[model samples]
Target: MAIALNTLVEEAERYLNASRIQDYCPNGLQVEGRPQVSRIVSGVTASQALLDAAVEAEADVVLVHHGYFWKGEDPRVVGMKQRRLKTLLSHDISLLAYHLPLDVHPEVGNNVQLARQLDIVVEGPLDPENPRTVGLVGSLVEPMTASDFARKVRIVLGREPLLVEGPQMIRRVGWCTGGGQSYIDQAIAAGVDLYLTGEASEQTFHSARENGISFIAAGHHATERYGIQALGDYLARRFALEHLFIDCPNPV
Candidate 1:
């Protein structure tokens, strides 16, 4: 079965509530291709390799959490950007990207999906006052030591996270998927025992140590993989279309 490209984009926009959120990049269709989409390929990012995979798979559209055209990115299409756009245009494959929208969506959001995988009971937003808070504070089903929590993250994400240990036992925790280490301040302010994000900055270590909160930097790709998969599966079921999640591994 196949659906119109516009129809799919519209449905995704509605489901993710894309318009209301402010993001670094535009959310929704970043590039247009074929009008009718039958097979969709989903991934964490729309890198050149993913585009090549989509072309090889004969995909009608490529859906992803990260896409081009950022706030400060160079406008001129050249070098890697030129190659990537060339591949999509030559093959007539549509590109649909959702950044913050995919990270914050209630059902298919990255943080919520990670929470489900790790058996976290969400308490509330990291910042309760901000309605669009992308990070969340939660508690584990059972309290465990910081080392044990790091072990759990490694087992689940298939990558050893950089652990900044604090406190003996961790009960309440806060997390945001994909480069959200900066949210540690909010997590600290919220009084959570631990904080988890995909990547960590130099200051993250200082913040974690000073605030007495455990911190973990799991692989960015690993932490963000689930949300796009969930969204792809939903789109497949909802539209009765073929969906495939292409994983292009990245250590960071």
Candidate 2:
């Protein structure tokens, strides 16, 4: 059974609490399509590949964690942007995206889903005083050497993570999904033995080494593949609509 396009968008907005969250891009229904939607295709990003896949799959709505019209991007619809928008417009496929909200959500959020994947017992927000912080403080089921934990990350993420090991075993941990290396100091302040994120900077190595906390930089795409799938499963069950998650692999 199909649902109205507006209903799907509204429910997603309410479920994600999108309006309350400040983000660099618009959160929901980036482009309007058919008045009704039956099948939804979700992905980590709204890349041309995903859009093409959605079209091939005959999806009515293309849902993603990253969407177009990001802040500071050239507002002109030309070149690549023009091609993407034209594809959606010509095919009558809606575009729906959620950035920070999808990262921070208590259920089906990227951070929380990643914790489950790695068996991290969540403690609390990485910074309790800051509502804007999307990272979380958590603990492992058992303490392991930093190297052992890094191996686990490699196994689960199917990519060799860059590890900066500290002298201590890892138990208490903090993490944010998708290019959140900048939060290392916040995790340090939270008294974590290790910190992990989707990407790392040169300074991240020094932070972990100098702070005596282990660090892992799992591939940004690998680390973030779960949350969008979880969200799609949830919406599918809720609305009795068909949902599919297509992963266009990114080595980075």
Which candidate's lDDT is highest? 2
Cα lDDT, all candidates: 0.93, 0.94
- Model 2 weakest lDDT span, ten residues long: 219-228
Q: List the residue pairs that clash in candidate 2.
A: none
**lDDT, residue 54, candidate 2:** 97
lDDT of 2 by residue, 1-252 (tens): 999999888889899999999999999999999999899999999999999999999999999999999999999999999999999999999999999999999998999999999999999999999888889999999999999999999899899999999999898999999999999999999999999999999899999999999999998888888888998888889899999999998988
Residue 140 in candidate 2, Cα distance off native in Å: 0.4
Clashing residue pairs in candidate 1 (N, C-alpha, C atoms within 3 angstroms): none
TM-score of model number 2: 0.98
Top candidate on TM-score is 2
Tell me how far the alpha carbon of residue 238 in candidate 2 is from the true structure, in angstroms, after superposition: 0.8
Give the lDDT of residue 52 in candidate 1: 93
